[model samples]
Structures are given as structure tokens and as C-alpha cells.
Target: MASVVWYVCLAGLLVAVSGQIVDDCVLVGGEKKSDVDVAILAKLAPLKNKRFEAKVEEGSDTYVYTFVVCGRVITNNTSTNEGLLQTKVNSKDSSVIGRINETHVISGSDWILLSYRGGDKYDSHCGSEPRTAMIMISCTKNTLADGFMVIKEERSKSTECFYLFEMDSSVACPPEESHLSAGSILLIVFAVLVALYLIGGFVYQRFVVGAKGMEQFPNITFWQEFGNLVADGCDFVCRSRPRSADTAYRGVGDDQLAEEPEERDDHLLPM
Candidate 1:
């Protein structure tokens, strides 16, 4: 039983360490399309009742954007749950645009992740360039949602480039208050003390009382003194009134007093 308890404690410690690691590094996002990425900074914007700006950058071969969104989440008063801050690159023309929603639903303390990939379908034409888009969404709290669209221009392999788009959201969920009551804590402490007292009492009764009883009889141990007392009483009674061969033999030397009684009677009568 003790080994089992130790193992359980070790497992809990390992889980806590692992959770800390993941929380520090991995960006929270939805698991399916249409599902919001909770890790993005933009997700938390609404929770603060403020609008945050999105930063966009265009590279020679790819474009990148950073944004913040706000949502409800469980956190300390000073901190907020930064939602998904994603970076995506269009493999074709390098054209990129990023957008993220500011609002989200409060579903416990879990997070979400949303992902997307380019598809072959053309959404529309931008200027003279034909645009196609694809999207994928997933949630950490539950099932993934429907895919959202992202529009990108088509281009030849020689001119093909990548476009990167990033969306960040923040959500804050209030921390839960402790459920333990003062009375409950007191009761637990009282129970533990009572158990210890009972154990101590039992040990004292078995060892201390028994040792004192043995000390009362100096000549013999307690058990040996009890046995000798019983034996001496039996011998005195059997010798005083013999009923069997063993008793008769024990009384043989004492029978000389019986003969003296007969001799005294003869002397007192006419003889």
C-alpha cells in the first residue's frame, strides 16, 4: 500500500512538470478549421475590452503578420491567455494577409488550435491574378470546427513565392476558488491526532502494563509465578487427603502421625 501511494505521488509530480513544459512553449490553437486558436494574442483583446493592432511584414519570398485577439480564460489577475499567433506562407505568389477574431466562448480552462492549407479552388481574381484559398481549424477543448477560407494569387513555379499570415488571440478564464472549508480542515487534523493517540494507548497497554505485571513478582516471571502458585495449591490439598497412588506416596512419611493417635488411645483405655 505504501509503495502504491509513492508511485501515485511520483506520477502526479511528473504530470505537473510535463504540463508546465507544454504551457511554457507550445502555442495554444484550435484542432480543426473554423475553431479558433486560443494561443493567439488577438483572442484576448476582447476580454480586455480593447482592440489590439496587427503587425504585418512582407519578405522577398514570403509575407508574415502578427496580431492579437481577446477571449475569456482562466488566469491570475495580472495575466491573460494569449491566443494563437500563427504565421502562414503562400507557396505561390508570396501575397499574405492576416486576420483574427476578438471574441470566444468560455469552455472551462482548455485551449484551441486552428490550421489551414492552400487549396486548388479559386475564390476570385485579384486584379489580373486568380486567387485560391484553403483553411483548417481545431480546438484544444473539444472537436475541430469547419474550415475557413484564405485567398491567395496563382503564379508560375519560376515566380512562385510563399505568403505568411499570423493570427494571435488571448482569453482569460477566472481561477476557481478553493473548495476546502475551515471546519473540514479542523476535522481532518482532529482525526489524525485521535488515530495517533489510539495507537499509542494500544502500545502502552500491551508493553508497559505487561512489563509492570511481570516486575510485581521478583522470584519468577509473571507467567512462571502464576504456574507455581497453581502447582503448590494442588500439592497441599492432595497430600492432606490422599485419593490416588501419587497422593498416597506424597503422604507416606506423614502417616506416622496416624499410628501415634492409635497408640495414645490404647494407653488411655484399660490395658
Candidate 2:
């Protein structure tokens, strides 16, 4: 049993150390990074070609947000707007809000957040820093309506700007894992241990001890004795008749008692 458990543990350790690639969204080769559930990302894969649009009015300017998942942002409006994330369109003029620098799926406290880093920098008035985008994808059970909304643009103290967006979809939900119960695991281990014991015992008894037939079994003598004891106990308990009192105990005036006095007659006379 101990040896079987050791082998099972060793196999599990090897699998964990191999670190086979399970998903692109999962974080690897990092110390403090947590693994992002790839199921959510996989659910969003179908939306890669589908672009989500939202319009938000702030002060005097209106902003239009268009984005996709696991791919570049393509609005199909013009060739110049191929990889742009957000576009600031006002009454008279239109400008780029953010350009795609890089995109990654990162793990949040309870959900997944997609980051779109724009490479294009803004003017000196906006701190001359590249605008970034964050899309918060939340899991939803409502399959009928998928919510898509733009939260707002946040301007930080460092003059850097961020476009915040939110999405509620069923794809962001974590996948359910199929796991074996404790009883199932224990039964498997016990079966493996029994197989190993039987095989090892057969090999040793057949070759090393030169045993034949049923004697090749391990602890055959002990098993045979145990079987006999069990059979005897069953017979005693299930007997139909009981011994008579005459045979159960010797009578005080039996013929053997009379013969015993005659056999000790010499000793009685001498003593």
C-alpha cells in the first residue's frame, strides 16, 4: 500500500513539474503571477471577429469605442483606423484616442480583464503618454441579453488617460472540472495495491522458493489456517443437537470411580 501510494505521488509530481501548456491566457514562468482560467478566454474566442461598439458623451466631446477579443481592432471604416482602439469624434473634428500597442488577458481578483496597451502617444497637454484600455469582462448567467457598456474615460494624476469598458457575457465564467471522489480514489489505490501484491508474491514463490500449484500464493499457510478456524466456528454455532448430560460430565458413582479406588488399594494400605 505504501509503495503504491509513493508511485502515485511521484507520477503526480512529474505531471505538475512538466508544466505542459494548457492555455495562452494562463500565466507561466512567473513567481507572483496567478494562472488565468483559459475557459473564459476560450468562450471569448468566438467574439474575435465580432466587434463590440459603444458611444459615451463626456462634456462637449463624444467618444466611440470599438474593440475585439484575441485579435486586432478593425472598425472597417478606413485603412487608417485598422488597429486603433478608441476614436474621439466630435462635431467638427475626429482624432485617435488610443492605438493598439499590445494585448493580453490577465487574471483579476474574481474574473478576467483584457488589457489593450496603445502605442500611440497623446499631446503634451495630456502628458504625452500613450493611452491604455481596460475591458472588464464579467460572467453572467443571463444567456438572453449580453450587456456591453462603456464606463468612462479616467484621467490620472500623472496625466495618463485610460478608457474603461465593461462586458457581461457567459464566456467569462469558469469551467467546471471533473474530479474523482475520495471513495473512488481510495478504491483505485486499493485495487492497484492488491494487484501488485499478488503479482509480486506469485513471482517470488514460483521462482525463488520453487513452490508448486496453490502453494505459490503468498501467506498460503496463514490463509489455510484462518479458513479452517472459520469453518470450525460456523459448524459449532450451527449444530442441530447438543450433547447429553451423561456424556457431558462424569457421574460421581461411575464404574471408573470404583476401579480407581481398587487401583490405589496398595497405596492406601501402605500410607
The sequence of per-residue lDDT tens digits that candidate 1 reaches over residues 1-271 is 6534433454355434432322222232442322122223223323232322333344654433322222212235843332322344554332222222222232223343332222222334333332222122223222122222223423433332223222222222222468889999999999999787766755665676663543433334555878898898888877755555454345546656554543346657775
lDDT of 2 by residue, 135-208 (tens): 88887755512566888767654675776778876655544556999999999999999999999999999999
* Candidate 1 all-Cα RMSD: 18.3
Residue 52, candidate 1: C-alpha displacement in angstroms: 33
TM-score top scorer? 2
lDDT of every predicted structure (CA atoms): 0.36, 0.59
Number of backbone collisions per candidate, in order? Answer: 60, 0
Cα shift from native, residue 154, model 1 (Å): 19
Give the C-alpha miss distance for residue 94 in model 1, angstroms: 20
lDDT score for residue 179 of model 1: 89
TM-score of each predicted structure versus truth: 0.23, 0.45
Give the top-scoring candidate (lDDT): 2
